[model samples]
Target chain A: MLLKAEKITKQFLRESRNTNQFCAVQETDFTLEAGSFAILTGRSGSGKSTFLHMLSGLMTPTSGRVLIQEKEIYSLSDKDLSAFRNQHIGVIPQGQSALYSLNVLENICLPYTLYHKNAHQEEALALMEQLEIAHLQAAYPSELSGGELRRMAIARAFLRKPELILADEPTSDLDDENTKIVFAFLQKAAREGAAVLAVTHETDVSQFADKVFCMKAGVLTEQNSL
Target chain B: MKLANSLPVRNLKGKPVRTAVLLLLTTLLTLTVFGGTLMIISLKTGLHSLESRLGADIMVVPYEATTKSNLETIVLQGATGYFYMDNEKYQKIASCEGIGQISAQFFLASASSGCCSLSVQIIGFDPDTDFTITPWIKKSYAQNLQKFDIVVGNDLNAFVGDTLTFYGVDCHVAAKLDKTGTSFDTAVFTNSETIKALIQSSVDKNMNEFKNINPDAVVSCVLINVAEGYTVEEVLNDINIHVKKVKAIQTKDMISGVSDSLSGIADIISLLIAVVWIAGIIILLLAFTMSVNERKKEFAVLRMLGASQRKLAAMVMQEALLVCLLGSLLGIGLGLLILLPFNQLIEELLNLPFLLPSAGQMLTDTIAAVLVSVLSGGIAVSASAFRISRMDTALILRGEN
Candidate 1:
């Protein structure tokens, strides 16, 4: 298994009530094999995003554990966990995730530069060309359209070519054509031996998934592939 | 570590207005701290130099001179005025009990000294009996002054071997003295013979106040040094009681007025510095806070990109450090620009002595001021860096917090 979650759960304390707690995600066990594409679908407030945040090691699970390549990720220190994620996993966040100050090309190189390493400019430009944002390399995020910005975010996540890819609403702002383009890219990443998990509301996303899951009211359930 | 060429600099460049405001605030803070401190130190140094240049225990001036002119204005300031008592008083003061050394000084003003726009005070001291001027003059001139040989003060336009015509009598400048930031800096010093000849020339020229004055058998003031066992007050009292027309004033008494004025000015400057620091810190704190609050989502995105909490905090601090470094150097440069060129004007405006310290001491002070400026900037932004580093990344990324 490239990624595994064993009975993971998340809870939030209601700010107005000191003694009360609300569970955002509940008792979820999941696993993904190498070179597999998984699609998670749920409505708003269904905790789909919350579950992905836990699996990606951005939030510590209230119970249970997440293991990536059989190493318990949350068991490591915060600094080590951050490094682990940078080297092994890529997360594409929801809306407006690009740093406004950096141009599109520089934004794509942020993962390398964050560790003070030299960026691979040739690889970054090749990825931008593949995503059709090569012409907008010098443009800042504010000058980009919703669809173009989403494509840039996708290209940035693939820059490091991580073993695991977690994306939230990857095609939320795209039209039908751009949506199909981004889904094909995610499927390609999985075929190249990466475990890719994408969360979306679009039912058509199931056509590209090797496995599918549904989240509703903080509870997760698996569904047969389309 | 390579922060100068990092995202911090690019971020600052992206938002030009915020960066400019921060730089301007830091600049003002350093300017006030460095410039204000330099002025206060210069005033204190000037006072010390004035006291050292006087180098006398007591001055016995004509009683009429004290009543007619401010003693500080005449001694510490190079205001042109003359008063004389009969030479009998000098002889009497010499024989007084516990007298260390007594020197008679002659005073004359040139109508048009050809050196300055205004008349300059020419002071003539008896070389054999002088205790005040001889030691300092020896540093520049080894030989005793001849009849026409003159040593000009630091502020004078004449140098060594230069001819200074005072009241139509050509005098040779033997040497120039170092600056003392006192009236001595503007006065010319020579032996009694040369001053007498110059006075006689002035009388022959029929200059105002030079007529009807006999240069013979007269001395303007007597500089006295108390013996080791004698107190200055005791000697001053003796001179005042036994003497008829002379008033003996202690050197400390002559400096008290200027010292009191300087104290008031120092207090005002200190208060202004405190206020500037408080205001600068508050402004910077608010600036950092507002800037961080507006970019909460950006910080969250960075966190999502696998930047640790410490890295985020370091980025904020790096931006502040770069801004402070540039702003403080510019401020020190501005302070030097303002203080060095207008030092004479500042001295005149304040009516107090102003002397800057040596170059090495000043450079050390500049470094200290720059460090303080940068440190204060760090302090001002510390709260923001901490808060943003600890913010909830998931909540911010979800756009809920």
Candidate 2:
């Protein structure tokens, strides 16, 4: 197994409500195997992004544990956990995720630079070429179009070549052609033995996913593989 | 990777206006601190040097000189003038009950004529009986002054071995005195014999203030030190009662006025420094807080990209440190350029003695000002850095909060 969640849940306090408590994600048990491409589909406010955040070690679960490769990630110290995430997990967050101050090339190499490590420029250039963003490497995020920014974020997520890739609504701003390019990239990474899990509302994602799941009202259920 | 390519430097380089404004704020902070401190120290040093240079406990001048305030102008305000009383009055002051030591001095003023380069005060002290000017002059010239040898003050244009002509009488400079930051710096000092010759030359040239008077029969002033177990006021009253045509004034009384003015100016500079310091810190705090708040999403993205909370906070502090370091150095450089070159003008404007501190002291003050400025900038941004580091990454990335 590449990633696993056992009875994980997230609750938020509702200050103005009489109940004074809200469950963003109910009890869920999930696992992702190596070399598998999984797609999570849900409506707005279905807690799909919340679940992906927990798996990426960004949001802490209110109950139970998150294990990646049989190691409980939340049990580690903040320093050790961040280092582990930097080396083994790659996340492509939703919306515009550029650091604004950095150009496209520096933003893509941030994961390596954050640890004061030397970045492999040739590999980063190859990824940019594959995403058709090689010509825009020297351009700042503000100068790029929405589709270009999304492609840049995807390129940055795959820079470290992590074993597991978690993407939250990664293709929400892409057109049909660019959406196909992004899905094909994720599918290719999965074929190369990286476990890829992505949350999206696009109907065409089923064609690329090996397994599919649907979430509703904070609950999750596995759907038959397409 | 080099630090020049780091995120903080890139951020500052990307927004030129914001970086410039922050740099200017810190520059104002350090300028006020360093300049104000140096001014206060110089004033205090000048006052202390003036006090020690006025070696007499009591001075007896001709009574008319006090009525015209001529002695005060010549001594305290750096003006040039001369007056004389009968030498018999000096003997009377010497025979007063509580006198420990007594010395008579002759004063003359050089004319701004073709023979002289500049008009200056010429003070002649009795070599055998003098106790005040000799000790100070000895620090520069050890040997006894020859008949026509002269000692020039620190601010005078004359140097050792140079000849200065007063009333057609040329006098050779023996040594230059150390700076006392007083009117004495502009005067020339010589023994009684050389000055009497100059005085006779003045009489011959029709420049003598006292017409038909013998130079050997009149002395300009008498300086006295009170005996042990006798207070300065007691001897001052004794001289006033016994002396016929002279005024007895305590040296301390002459200096009290200058001290009061110096104290008032020091207080105002200190208050100005406090006001600027407080205002700078408050403005910096507001600027950093607003900047960090507006960039919450950017930091949240870094968090999602595997940056720890510590790294996020350190990046913010590093940006502030870079601005403060550069700003403080610029401020200190500006302070030196303004304060040192125009010090003489400042002294004249305030009408008080002013001396700069030693070079080592100035170096220490420079370091202290830079450290204080950088530390205050750090303190101003600490709260904002801490708040941003603890922000909710998931909500910020989702645009939920």
Candidate 3:
């Protein structure tokens, strides 16, 4: 497995009520290979985002292990995890579109700037051209069409050439034609040797992935082929 | 100012109101601390100048100490205060090895002018022999030097050239000094011979008591100027051994008895200003903390970008230092503006007699303000950054409440 999780669970505690802890997700187990795109899908409140956060190492499970490239990422310190998030992995958080201050190119080059990695503008331009969104490269997010903005978000997520990429409801606002185009870019990213794990309640993005996992009550069940 | 180098700077322009408020508050705090400190510095400067002008190496007077000083009658006005020692003792006191020069001064009682009975004191000093009177004589020698010539101190110049009949003795103002802001500034200077002649005239005016008076016992106090090799202590010991019936006191002993009480009052005024300075710092700290809290996501984002907490703390401190430096500069400028002219007013209030912070003192105080502001900001930044860094990155990523 290129990425792995074992017996992972998460808990939420109440400070005001002094009540016992409640579980957000429990005993979550999943793995994905390097070149496959997987979708973790569930209805709202079914812990899909929580599971995705754990898989990306942004949130640590209460009592389990998450390994990427044979290193237990959750066991690493916060400093190391930040380093990991900057380079070895990528995340596209929902609601906030490509950082409010950045132009599309700047947003695409964020991982390089954040990690102090090589300023690979040539590679970013190549990716933009490869994904057919090079025309919108200089535009700020506010100036882009919804389809172009979705493409911009994806460019940022895959900026670092990470071993894995995680996206949360990335195309929820995109049109059907734009959704197909986004899935094509994501599939291309997987074929280019990065694992893409997408969390969505929408079935359209799920059908594009090679593998799909449905989550419920903190449990995830994998589908062999979507 | 080019965009290439101003991307980070442009971030401030992105939110002008917040940045302006932050800058304004920082300026106010800096100005307050520096302004108050500058005032204290100005007061001290005034006091130092007054001390410089006093020019007395040693003073001899009764032990009763108070703050008020009158340059004229006490020095010019003879027979005003308690002790009237025999002027003949000046000769014996001068015999001491360390006794290089001495001036005998007499304080004559208050005299009435044309309309209002103004408070007056006068002093008597031999401009030819007295060390204390010699320095003052230089100030008057330019205008007109006469046996009965008088150089009025700065404040007494208000009554300058006003022909005042002191016990029916007449003298004209030969020159007047710029106010020293000391009690001396309120006193008039006349020739020692003229003052003696006036006092003897006054004594003679009360002609019934002429039989009981002693002619040799004339002046008020002997101001001793000790030699360079010896201190006032040796001179005091010498004078006590050689002379009889006169007490000797060093300049500082005199100041401690007089100026110290007045300075004690000024010290309280400075303390109140210091409170305002401290309050300004505390307010600045609170503003910085609020700014830090508001920019949590910004710091978190920076942290994720490998910007260390140390760097973040340094940035805050640097900003604070800049604010402090700018504020302190503005304050020093404002202080100098207030002092360069109104210095006389401050001296009058503090009884320093003159005040102006020097360029060197301004530089030192600016450096000190910068150091203090940055240190305070660094501490505040570290405090808030501790809370910020401890936050789960997941909270930011998830956009959780």
Candidate 4:
């Protein structure tokens, strides 16, 4: 196993309108083998995105040890941990995830460029080529269509060859062609030895991952094995 | 660092419309500030040098000129139009107790032609014993000076020949005075007899011009020299009480009064302009704060990416510094462009034979302008940076764009 997120719990502090604190995630134990792909499925406000945030080192779980090769990312200093997350984990947000400041090539290369990693322009082009939009390399994120943007976002995640990829709603609202392209890339990344976690409600993307986890309220439970 | 480095100056690449608006306002603010500073400095330096070269303790001109505003127009410019004393009164002044050597200068006017309107000041003095004018007089035609011979101030001699008609009488330019860097730079000088004769004839000529029955007017303003131990005020009071019709003013008093009067209206205008400039700086602060606020999401994302609050603040500060640096630099360059043309225009009109930065005031004004721009920009960032650092990362990550 390359990562273990065991006994994860998260509580969100509610404002004075309710004057109450509520747990968003509670005691969720999870394990992922190297090169495994999983889909986290949940309804709105069901804590699926919260769990993915903890797994990606973007947010800390109230209680848990999320270990990537036995290094607890949440426990590291702010700078050290962000560096670790940028180096080893890739985060892909929902639709319109691409930063407009970067062009198609720069958007795809952002992961490596922002972290000061050695740049490989050819690799970013190759990834975009696989998504069938190699010709759109110079296009801005705003100029691209929904499908082109989603493909570009996936390329950014895969650019650095991160050990773990966490994407939120990887193919939500995307057309069927884009949906297939996104799923195909996620599966390929897993097969190539990266742990991939996609949080989604879409049934089409859910079926593509090797394993699945379901969340209700603030708790996670095993739904299937690969 | 890498983000800013990786992108073209964001103004060039960022939302093009917003960048254009920002650049326009920044450029206007900078130009106004830079040009305003140069004008102020130039005026001050011009006046300061004027005060420094006046070789007198007290200048006893007519009270009408001194009592009026300091910028009162006078033709007391060169040695050619010098003032002669009331003869017995002159002897009385030389005899006064606590009095030092009295250097009496007699005026003789010379026109380019006997008919030309252009006139120059020709003053006559005793070759020895004159303290005020002799220190810088160089030499006074050392070999000999007769009634028709003259020694001219530097630039004045350069124009007229060795023999120019003074009071319609021909006079020789015997030798010359060193450059005085003063209004007197265009005056001619000679012995008392030459000047007295010239005045007698000029009176005769003006009497002929006006067809006056007697001399039109006898000389301009008389200058009094005081001993080293005596202050100008002491001599002024002594002359006021002892001498009749003539008033005495200390050199230092003339300068302060002149500066006050010369810049009085300008000071009022400068104050109003200064307020406008201050408003400009405040606008820059508001612009910078708004600019930073617009990028709040971008900065929050950087913070989420593990950039510390300090680093994020530095990034914002860097943007402001660039704005101020560019704005001020452009303002200064623009100011120089404006000043170059304007200065030439002023120098031509005034001929400023001895111009100094209008009076001791140029430097302070320029410094105030640059400070307003940079200090405001720096303060604006500091005010907003603290609030930014406290922003919650999770909220930003989930917040609506």
Best by lDDT: 2
Cα deviation of A153, candidate 2, in Å: 2.0
Candidate 4 has a DockQ of 0.36
Q: Scoring only the second chain, what is candidate 1's TM-score?
A: 0.95
What is the TM-score of each candidate's chain B when compared with the real chain B? 0.95, 0.93, 0.67, 0.69
Question: Mind giving the per-residue lDDT tens digits that candidate 4 earns over B112-225?
Answer: 544234677666666655555555554544465677876666555353345677667888766776544455556666776676676677667662232332222333344566
Better of 1 and 4 by lDDT: 1
Name the Cα RMSD for model 2.
2.4
lDDT pick, better of 3 and 4 = 4
Model 1: per-residue lDDT, tens digit, B248-353? 9898888888888999999999999899988998899999999999999998888888888899999999898888888899889999999999888888899888
> Residue B170, candidate 1: how far off, in angstroms?
1.1
TM per candidate? 0.96, 0.94, 0.70, 0.80
Fold similarity of candidate 3's chain A to the true chain A, as a TM-score: 0.91
All candidates in order of lDDT, best leading: 2, 1, 4, 3
* Model 4 regions lying over 4 Å from their true place: A16-18, A115-118, B1-5, B62-71, B75-84, B100-220, B262-278, B300-309, B344-372, B386-390
In candidate 3, what are the lDDT values of residues A37-69, reduced to their tens digit?
Answer: 988888877888888878777677888889998
True contacts kept of 2: 0.60
Q: What value does the interface RMSD of model 3 take?
A: 4.1
lDDT of 2 by residue, B377-396 (tens): 99999999999888999999
lDDT tens per residue, model 2, A1-226:
8899999999988878857788989999999999999999999999999999999999999997999989899998878788888888989999999988889998999889888888777888899999999999999999999999999998888999999999999899689998899999999999999999999999877999999999998899999875
Q: How much does each candidate deviate at the interface, measured as C-alpha RMSD after superposition?
A: 1.3, 1.0, 4.1, 3.3
Greater lDDT among 2 and 4 belongs to 2
lDDT of 4 by residue, A1-226 (tens): 7889889898877775566778889888888887989898888889887888788776778887899989988788877886787677777765455657667887677666555566789999998889888999988877998888878878877777888888888787887877887888899889999999888888766667899889999878778775
lDDT (Cα, 0-100) at B348 in candidate 3: 51
